[model samples]
Target: MKKQHFLVKQMPPEEIELEKKRAELSILEDDLALKELDLTTLQVVLEDLRRRYLRIVGVKLAQLDGIEAQIAEIIARLDPKNEEVKKEADRRRTQAQESADATGSIAAEEYEAEPFKPSEDLKQLYRDLAKKVHPDLAPDEQARERRHRFMQEVNQAYSERNEDRLRSLLNEWENRPDSVSGEGTGAELIRIIRQIARVHNRIEAISQEVENLKESELYKLKMRVDETQDESRNLLVEMAAEIDGQIEAAIARLKNISQRVEKTERSRTKQRDSKR
Candidate 1:
């Protein structure tokens, strides 16, 4: 048996570090790409799920309405002079009205469901923090530590949905010592701005795609189509389950990557500080 020839190339320290950074960036890029793709796929699946749920709810409500109508007919058959029948009809009417009210509330809640939107203050704070803590700015230990802390604060504020804290953090950054100044600051600021803009643009694009899916005739037709195709409906259910699994997996991967990145950054900062 002939062994496969393995090629080995030796690289300089600088080249090796560059390669490592490139690899890290590439992994992050791939993760983001996968997340975007998964999100798109999930959105379609979610829309299908929504349509199916709506169809089922609509059918149930229609049946309820029909039953209510039948009850009305039965009540009409009883003489108005019959006290027991009149009272029973009143009770049934009240129950039907209550059911209708509850269903309407549910539909309203579903229709009104909206994605979380950070307040203007919070957004401004995030931008400010991004400028300070951006990995590129970590040229020294102190700066790197500041960056890490700022990033932590940014993440915390975002998770808590604390617009006030975000706004305060932005204000603090503006007034803080070691704040970047001049054209250099402007360049760094632009990079941070662009990063946020990219995320927002992506989110908006996804939202529009979701809206398009909802409005699509095919989506509507699918609901009708599903009624006739048991196999297709079953397939959609399977796909939905698969999508959920993918999302959970993606989330786990992201968490692991995030922790690794943070740990690496902290270690690098400590090493740099010790040298100083």
Candidate 2:
């Protein structure tokens, strides 16, 4: 046989383009993931603060309640018309309860149904994401760890209805260098195209989440609280201190009322005057 010359052709522009995309997407995914972690941590902290604020407020209110009742009772004995104060307080309390019942409750809110029910769409999305990033599918231990973290985030985002996050993750992982290569089969190319569409969906979801979080009341409150800080004191610490002061003031008021009550315990003249 005669010696023959052979030639290898360079990859087409389309295949080259796909290879470039995989590199760019991996970098972008890393950036988005760090951002995701920050937002998630903020959200978790905000929720915990909100719950703590309500619980502390409840404790303070309960402490003040006994003092308030004592004051009202004493005032009513001293002046019969003060009974109206208790009636008015009752009416306002009822109105407040009705208003809260009309809206969703975050704290002291009772629910008749499950608080978090995954939508059918959400469940479907979650299934897709889980399959895409399942740790067992990773080719090596390092890849396995990465996928494991991705799956954790996927589970969290799914639980929290962060569909943008879930879809984004699906798009992000599909572009993984190992998963998508210039030499990928036709089936893989089709999957990549579908994932590109999912990335578009992810962008929209992220935009919505940004708007929603910025508009959230808790976010606003947190911003305000953050402004009231020094090296030694934080917002929650200051609030606790204020509550303690109020509780002390309430006890003093209760003691003053009790003293007056004792002083007048034998005064029939004050009783007759109250009746008049």
Candidate 3:
């Protein structure tokens, strides 16, 4: 066989630099997608825990508040002439009603019907959609706003574990006018550079948000509850039980106050009859 020579064309410096920037942009996009997904997942989990906490512990707290209000009402009735007592009773009643309304609004089985656990396929789709349509990747403020709205729906679908909706959103983005890209090595490089900056800013924002979430009081309590779960201790149930004890004590106090108010009324009636 005869030896043969083949030539390889060297790319221009600008072209080479553009290629490098493109590679960097690709990697950043991937990182941004993953980070956004993680942040969304954390938010969904925390929100679920919030609902569970309201349902379990908050309801009992509301009940206890109601009993306290009852006690306050009885005390006020025993001294009808005291404005302070009547005002305190009204305040307690209002507080109890608000707490009851707040707790009652959380559905008892809202999350139990279907867990928010996303399958691997669902996660993959979400990551793809996030990378393709992230608002920071938009070229202008108007485009960014549009992307923001679209991404909201995407995030909602992902949180709900709606794979079909996510797939539909991906298709919708592909067909959207903004999905088109312009070409020209120099101009493309400028665009890519701007994109890189935007993506970096977005990634940092996601990090800050995730940190804030982790530092929240609710998140701390959730972590403690999870830690106790590993040790076979149901902290939420225990919390509810603790509240139940308080509720029982409050009920007893309310009963005692009610009995006192009745006895006072009976004695006053007897005195009025004797005077007549």
Candidate 4:
């Protein structure tokens, strides 16, 4: 067998070192790819959950808020001198209307389709592109910003599940002049070291973001909703039904309050007429 020294002698020391760093950078890029994928997937799932929750439970809650606001306004009218109650009534009415407007803005088509599920090919292609073009792998600030722009398109294509768009982007990147880099071996090695440091920082940032997302109340609710889904039960629908109950109760209270106010106003008018 050939000697280990012979293998070392096959290339200049700096060249060999450069190759080693390139390999390390490639591995780190792959790691960053997976982390980014996880973050994107979580974002997509959470967004879907949010829209569904708003459509179901949020609208009903808005309705309840509106009825309660009506009740508050009637109460405020009965005690016209109570500025605090009037202010509270106005605030509730504004909030209820805003909530109703927000609920109305969600497009019906957004949640009508089946859930997002990328194909194996699409996922692999995204990972490959991320490894090749992730901003964190850039050797300079300018290159990093350029890579960031390209990566945004890449991410958008991936999120939209447009394989054709991703392929087009890959082709465009390959044709770009900046895709190629060159320098003295020592300089290149230094660049690679800096890039590796940046990649580490980015990876840590992504981990922190993921942790924050997981800890959020919205995410916790999403997890509970998902669990209920697995059990063939619809948590959002159930929540909406509960809200519906509350809304009906609020409506009854509003009706009762309005009738009481009307009866009191009629009695006052009759007493004034009797005096006249």
TM-score of each: 0.27, 0.50, 0.87, 0.89
Q: Is candidate 1 or candidate 2 better by TM-score?
A: 2
Q: Give the candidates in order of lDDT, highest first.
A: 3, 4, 2, 1
Worst 10 residues of 3 by lDDT: 107-116
Candidate 3 on 31-121: residue-level lDDT in tens?
Answer: 9999999999889888878888888788888988898898898888888999999999999999999989888779545545332567999
Error of model 4, residue 142, in angstroms: 2.3
lDDT per residue for candidate 4 within 1-276, as digits (tens), equals: 975654344888899999999999888988999898888777877777777777888888788888888888888999999999999999999988988887887744556444566788888888888887889887778898999999999888887889999999888887887743666888899989998999899999999999999999989998898799899998888999998888888888888888899999999999999999
lDDT of 4: 0.85
Candidate 3: where is the Cα deviation over 4 Å?
Answer: 1-10, 80-87, 108-115, 175-183
Q: Which 10-residue span in candidate 4 carries the lowest summed lDDT?
A: 107-116
Model 2 spans with C-alpha error above 4 angstroms:
1-8, 12-14, 51-58, 65-87, 91-184, 224-229, 251-276
- For model 2, state the Cα shift of residue 232 in Å: 1.7
Q: Report, for every candidate in turn, its global Cα lDDT versus the true structure.
A: 0.55, 0.61, 0.88, 0.85
Of 1 and 4, the candidate ahead on lDDT is 4
What does the lDDT come to for candidate 1? 0.55
Ranking 2 against 3 by lDDT, winner: 3
Distance from true location, Cα of 244 in model 4, Å: 1.2
lDDT of 1 by residue, 142-203 (tens): 66578668767766666456777767777777687774433544454454444444445555
lDDT of 2 by residue, 82-200 (tens): 76876755554555455344332544554222224456776667666654565544445676688779888886886577878878888887887754334444544444555555444
